[model samples]
Target chain A: MERLLAVRCPGLIEEDESGGVLRAFDRVVAAVEASCPWVTVVRTGICTLPIRGPARYFGGEHAVVDLVTAAAVEAVEAAAEAVEGGSSVEAVEVGIAEGTFAAVLAARTGTIVEPGGTTAFLAPFPLAVLGERDLADVLARLGITTLGAFAALPERHVLGRFGATGVACHAVATGRSGNLPGLADPGAGRRLHALRHPPPPPDRQPGFWGGASEADARAAQVLTRVQGLLGPDGVLTARLQGGRSPAERARDVPWSARSRAGRSGGTGSQPPWPGAIPPPAPLLVHRDRPAAELVGLDGTAVAVSGRGVLSGEPARLSVAGGPWERIAAWAGPWPTEERWWTRGHRRTARLQVVTAGTARLLVVERGSWQVEATYG
Target chain B: MFDSVAPGRVPGRVPGRTAAPASTTPGGRRDPSALAALDDLARRIRPTAASGTRLLPVHPALAPLLPEPGLRRGSAITVTAAPGLEGTLAVAMALVATASTGGSWCAVVGIADLGAVAVDGIGVDLERLAIVPRPGPHWAEAVAELVDGVDVVVVHPPFAPRPAAARRLVARARERQSVLVIVPGRAGWPEPPDVRLTVESSHWEGIERGAGHLRRRRLLVTGGGRRAAGRMRRCELWLPGEDAGPGVAGVAGVAGVAGVAGVAGVAGTSGASEPA
Candidate 1:
């Protein structure tokens, strides 16, 4: 499918006269990165840049066009948020086309064109898009209502009457004009990923595990493993039950969101039930040290598992105002068993205890206790 | 309260009306008559006339053009200007300054061209001023909506279809009892108005450095339209200080124009002919 996207940064001009426009431009670029990983942002401003590399990388001009359109929309949304006045920014219109001039013209007229159809699309557009005063007036007087009519006029006659502007307009109308020189290429193919997992229960079997006693822990481990496999560019698609059906859900996802999953391997599996697996634990890798210290201040005792924990030491530790305090009382090997279906790495033990000062609950899996969940 | 007309008297002086006292004073004691006269004077002075009118000070240049010396509680005036940055800023500042002094809430609709510095320099109360830029194609309706709440509304004319809409806006101003200043382009409209003042550039001599002072201006003012062809007057106005006090002086041989010179300064030139 061929698609064209136009992104707009509304209120950029009003927000900052000097450097704000450039900042807004950077924000749009960042938003496109976050949303549509496979698409590239072509030319930044009114100018046009080459798209040959992006088209070749995406396997054809059609796919590249679709990817560009999706990324542009995402970028526009991001730009809107980054703007000073928030969403109240003036109306911003975007247009995508096969040719640079055609795309710009479409944006001014609030329309988008299909790939390889620049000539057909330019037919209805007014000649005012050229941004030249003299040529526009002449075009209007020549009984030319649309760009198609202007382009159909004899090239020699047009050039003779209007000079360079007429020649440029005719070239753009025909979609055979070269990309404006000296402009930098916006780059190619964004990194997008999407993944979905099956619901947890009797009906939906775990990846390699079974049963409900330690299902939560098994599910957490499986998700962590999957995240590792996807690498940094990958995005997991978590499909919860309720609302729309799976078929409808696929169509409803925005192009950016669809593209996010493309980075991790194309498409991920869907949940067995509509609302099956419990929501994934928040991705808490690389938690800030200050945040960890503050968490310690809550006076909650947590149990830790894995290689960091030492055996026979009191598994319960209290997190109070400053650092972790090893609690002498309220210690026990709570014993958490996960992934019973899988051998060797199937089961694990976690300890549970409450701190003395705050009486907060903490869980430690295996041999160590780190502040996990705090209870009143 | 003491009664001013009453006086103290000695008891049994007449002796049952048998004989007059051997006092040679003619007309007896005049104390009673004097007290009565005093009482009459007191009663006359007790009640004073109440003043129902109030004085409002405005920019001296705009004073004569307004129906009252300054803007009153209910009056509509239209101010138009050229399209460039200088002209728009000049008109916006003047209107804002006038409204701010009167303690009236002012609103600028569809006037995005005004810069923040220009608005601040004009001393518009930011708390009282509301600027709505690009109010869309329905600018007239938007202005009308603001009319009910604001005391004054200054609207910049749209790129198209402005003249007829301006007349409707004037009517809206009257309906809401709010003053409306329409900033028009170069073309002057034929709309009938209570007062029309045309501002034109003139050579101003003796202006202090960095202070806005106009020593002379061709201010064409025509009052009374349709009902009466009011008097037309052309006057020269000079600014004496930063406080915007007028230093009016009479010019010779100017007809149909009132010449108001500083009475104190013209004491030596009493016989000078006043321009009228």
Candidate 2:
């Protein structure tokens, strides 16, 4: 009679720094929502959803999990699309059991609990997670560590000391509270009617316009107003993105395909990403197609010697044809030897130098000196 | 066609942005204001972005080395060294580190010599990594599985695969929105890749012939192919570079998309010192 599915992400929510990534949590919500209507999300990325209805619809528990997994993948993909290069959801553990708590712990282990295995599955959990930290400490002091041990304690004694909270804990600890939380999706039963259908033209408000040209003028006026509300620069125009190779990476999704995907509400059915973190990269990665030559104080190239030794101390380099500045501080002459045993072998070195102007540059030396990179 | 050198040869690959009165170069590095505006656009979309990124985060050093911005999903690039490995794996790991640390899964499909310990030491979370050491005859199929399940798949084909099979794998990668990194080996790929990156050479600093230990390395990465075409981007970046040790691996990289005839090692930020 109990079919609760618990999905848990170990440190997801608690690890959020600015709470911006919290929006990504919707990836999980939308994923499960695809399979069932009754979902209750708890803190710590733990979600409990009743699967009885979905199981019936999908034919069995295995089939339901498969469908849920697929939906979860789609949700993750959507999150990736939204943030582009963000910290995305790549994996999740789902647990199915008779009740919420059991399913939660089961999810922690990343395995499924059979229909009748709830008791055996839960008996191994440490009493520390049994709720009521103070009581759990007391129980621990009394030599009870595992739920199996605490479950052996007399019910009357537990009731006498712990009272209502104790009884509830005992019920969960003994796997008797599997049916505690109510099972109904509050949002599932209520259908959203807005995007479902557009309002008919007959229901449109009539304007006091004289002719078609006047209506067109009014529409232009309205567009200006909307632009004002949304801001002149807020509307993002599609542009080609760049990368090292794929020409596609530089192109936007064709407008027609994008419209078709949007019309399908491919995203409408999904929820937003919550607490989803984006990847941490720098402001810009400048290329090395153009470089400056760094020379030592002696007016000679700051070269890595044939013996992989520096010819002299680094002194200066012209910046993009700008004036040459003195090197303030420097480090390196790291030698690199690749394919040494073959014909294409190369032996070279590099150095990190800070200029008197306080600019940083990575200089490379093969037969000549070149500024490899600058520190922002 | 997938050569990471001489990208200008490819057809249908146009300049990144239209030429403005000031946009002389394809990437327009000469236009400082344009670069500043691009940074502003990044801030507009995600203001508090870790590094003001409009694209995915790559090592600060390797950013400008990319053809456009940073790496994107659904893009496949081949990483090769003229005749050796030379920082190829190190750079690949750095790129993947951006996504992997953020909870995404990464899989290494065909490289058998790789061990989980060394990879874990390079900052890849072993828990999220799937290793397929020996795919044998089903190398392509194995990569397909990883592409389906993980976000980044680093594959070095054990043997030459048919062009049709390679194309199918590439299509799968696009459909699934996963990144496929093809590292060239003895057998080589039957067809060209969308993007090709080659480590033309590497310069190691902090070592004296055979005495001192190498503290850092500068990898000369050349990127070209259909996407880059005539506007090939070249850079000298670090790969775990000696000083990058495990702790600094995520923060390591230096991309100087240098041009030919002293025009190499262009402008940019230091990567080895910052996290992407």
Candidate 3:
């Protein structure tokens, strides 16, 4: 089916002052995806390329156009709202026609031309819609205000007066033009699947929130729900009871406490906590891959065991640059003290040294002096 | 040199009327007749290119210590601190704040010891900041890459490196016009740098009252290099806010330094320091 799509940034001019136009566009795309599963939203500069394959697969021209129109409008509206300080002013202008050029002209001129009426729809538009203002103005000077007027002139006369641009405008106005095909069909049955599952039990709902007393059970239930939602994705978002969410709670808790609790409260004595989730290790992921350590520039890596035990010897260290000389002066085991009773146990040994030219602080466990953190 | 002539005896009006110069130039130009007058005026208004570039003014105490009195677009400077996390972080943060004010891109490479809040407290624009955690043994290479991409790259090297690698990185920094600030983790460098500022704790006070005070020892600057044999200068500085009047003072001590006194007019001693 042929579809008409209109994408616009009503507050585009004011975007600098209020921001969020791009974010709104994202939401608009999301909403469109949610509503019209078969319509693909193309994001070229000023125009959208709607492929006809999916439209044809679904049915015919009218159905595709309707889907495209609905999706486009919904997306634009949602995007406008998503923008910070966004309002209804950022409305989209949609126009549909048989040809890509015709459709683009119709959209720019705010006209929706009926199918097979591309020539008539484009006829009234000024040649400026063709994106050649100079030629359009020249034609208008000769009393050719609209495309139809310009096209009515002799072909030789247009060519003689305005060159290729004039001739192109004439051809499009007369309904004899060539451009790229419309968007292909966005495959039928290729919609994003949001699986519907049974709601949580009444006791697990926010209405039944029981502070601390039911915190563990509720947390477990939330995790189970998240796992179900994530499926094999391995990533999950869980909504917990109370004012704060589960993710917020996890971040607020200390890493040391979570790590030392040992999945079974440590001390080799207790059963694993029902819903405790361990924190991710402090792993630094770089966008670019790194080479193995070079002699002078490489830094030592020390490993610390749980319960503040030091393992292995202090290895060679890496250097980037700075005052390596001064840092070397005091390079040794430096103790760090932390209150173990606190929520997050943060006792560590900081070895200060300079390698290469940079000064760094390599943190080891206070008791063991094994590596924990590095300041580069 | 015209001073207010007290009740002059020269021309128009009363006995107290002061004579106005008949010449067009307020202070007569140096014709043979005007030579003495011009010489006297020259003594009154001597200009010296304002001493430093107004575009980028380094702290007075730091001016003499740096290769130039001000940091330019394409220059590398390093700050060193005593062994510990606190001092190194303080220096790194100060540099970040300084670079940010100049609208340059600043990145912390291989340094994850600081909390975001602490860095922010030192006035570093966190929004424009990019922090990279310790990238293991290949830190120098990572730092070189970062330096190429950013205006300033602050790296805290663990300990000594082979002399060859250190020289290579230094060449890279000079080629790219990127500032490489190395926070020394160990002691002794294979080569001396263009400029080096060593930081040591003189004293710290006000911890109990929640108002933290850091008193740093004198900044010892050594110029040239081992081969060239550089000059050494030491200076003391304190951070204090400028008052409504003209004079500058040390926050907790008397402003003794002579060279730094004149340029201490900037408000807020947050980043103030005297150049040696």
Candidate 4:
């Protein structure tokens, strides 16, 4: 099961028509994202982030929990002050466990379940914790009120009675899968995306009369026409941001009337990252990562060590199983130890490899190499 | 006639715009540098109204490779490379970088994965650049529409554009007075362009087995086409010079530096000559 740490904002759990709760939740998520990247939003107030990477970075899971709990408290307090005009702040709850389902339950009671102990930790909880009111009522009527009792039922017998949802819940109860199909709000991501990239502000007006120059007005008209032919997301304007790789440093946002202002701003305030690839960024950053293979002089596969050293001196390379070409010259193994906890963690490092005619950025994750970008 | 209206304006606004007090003296004492300075002054002092029909500025290093002083408006320039050659896209980006920075709105079509940072590093203004990554089958229509308003439209057609469609698009660019740059990578262009620039080969320097990073690339660019651009021209260039901007290999001084450490790359030799 995927180990996850979940944050449950009890005050913001229920949807509010005013959108104040979601806004507050956004602050909490942002606060958490500052210390950790890739904070996944499971719902409006509830969120989960993978623990392996951060756990290792912050020393251990206990340290990460302490850090996140403090950050969430401060963010929630500030948000509550803004939303409710200085009402008493509610206590934010956080927990860590193997699966998101168990982790969220653990968050409600503010406890951390030890690894390999999720099923034991969840045994005493009532069926109501599953959030299935119908199943809880039926199970209560049958005198099987606790999760332990329901989990004790035969898998086939429960499926015969309760159908697919029952089978999924049973799997969660047995601690087999971290996923529950309907547990996460599918619309949360879209709603957050809308919040992050709102429509162009009214001040940045387009066309000839008021602010924009004549050329901008003409370009806006034709770009809008192209948008009509190819949807709104078709035409995009590029913006530079701070990141470790070429793809991360730059992003293409859909072109709009506001883009005519052409403010290609940089992340001036971003903290410097140590392992970022040196300048002269690649000409192309592949959208679909292509598989690659790097072999040493004797034809053995090359890899990166735990200490960021190359396992072999690469001499030949092939991409997507193509014919091998000699590695004429190469640069450093710019190692990025993002997540190196266990076997499946994304412990990857990048290298700039030049063949007879081309230069490419190759990343090796899980002992397999992939072409990340090309200096075309 | 309007040259004196902004007599000081031209030199003040443009860097490297020398007053050329020595050239003010008459008596057929003109030199090549003086004539080049006069030509530059003429271009800078030209009224904005005439800019609609005038050539768009290109990086000075690439000026010799083109038939005109700069990229001519209302024309098509196709960039191509041999099957396995690299740097075609880099050359195309370098071609439009100057005009884009000079306030020309440019659009890219059907070329996803364009490294905008590198484009910016090559001196292209990202703000004036719009990219239509995947126009699907409507790429021709998208390019046609963009060509109407955009000053330069760079398109890499996902498939071979029909000759008639390509001709019509070329004609549209001519009518609209927009420069069209085609990078027909794999999906070849059927219609003949006004000027076709091909990258014969590309070589990278500043990196050897496990040492320095990739610092620069040298490209061999050849230009040829019909009509005024009939004569073939070739130029050696660093598409990404030492500082990551394009520069003429011959004049950049760093050109003499061989691909070796210590001996070829002595301190202050190359850096002192590069343009600030």
Off by over 4 Å in 2: A1-376, B1-55, B115-118, B228-230, B245-276
lDDT score, candidate 4, position A107: 77
Question: Per-residue lDDT tens digits of candidate 4, residues A272-329?
Answer: 4577887678888899989999999999999989788999899999999999999989
The C-alpha lDDT values of all candidates are 0.38, 0.50, 0.39, 0.73
DockQ of each: 0.01, 0.03, 0.01, 0.18
Model 2 C-alpha lDDT versus the unseen true structure = 0.50
Error of 1 at B197 (Å): 1.5
Q: Report how closely model 2 matches the true complex, as a DockQ value.
A: 0.03
TM-score of each model, paired residue for residue: 0.27, 0.33, 0.31, 0.56
Tens-digit lDDT track for model 1 on A1-376? 1233444333332213222334455555554433332223333222222344455667865565456546545555655655565553434445567654555445445555666777787676555444344665777787875667887888898889978756876776666662322111221101000001111345564323523323233323422332233332221222212211112121111112112211122222222333211111111111111122212224443334454242443433424445554442332333444444668553333233323322222333332334442211
lDDT score of residue A9 within candidate 4: 71
Quote the lDDT for A233 in model 4. 93
Model 1 root mean square deviation, Cα atoms: 39.8
| Residue lDDT tens for model 2, A71-109 | 765665565444333443444557688777777666556
Give the C-alpha interface root-mean-square deviation per candidate: 43.6, 30.0, 28.7, 29.9
Range of the 10 consecutive residues with the lowest summed lDDT in candidate 4 chain A: A261-270
Judged by lDDT, which candidate is best? 4
Clashes of each: 30, 61, 65, 0
Candidate 1 lDDT over B1-276, as tens digits, reads 000101212111211100111211122222455445534533332221112212223555435445556544324454542221122323334444545544445666655433322232233433334455455565665565555445566666555535445544565454444566655545544456544444332222222221222222122222222232254434333222112222233322342243453321211111110110
Evaluate residue A281 in candidate 2 and report its C-alpha lDDT on the 0 to 100 scale.
14
Fnat by candidate, in order: 0.00, 0.03, 0.00, 0.49
Chain B superposition TM-score per model: 0.53, 0.65, 0.57, 0.73
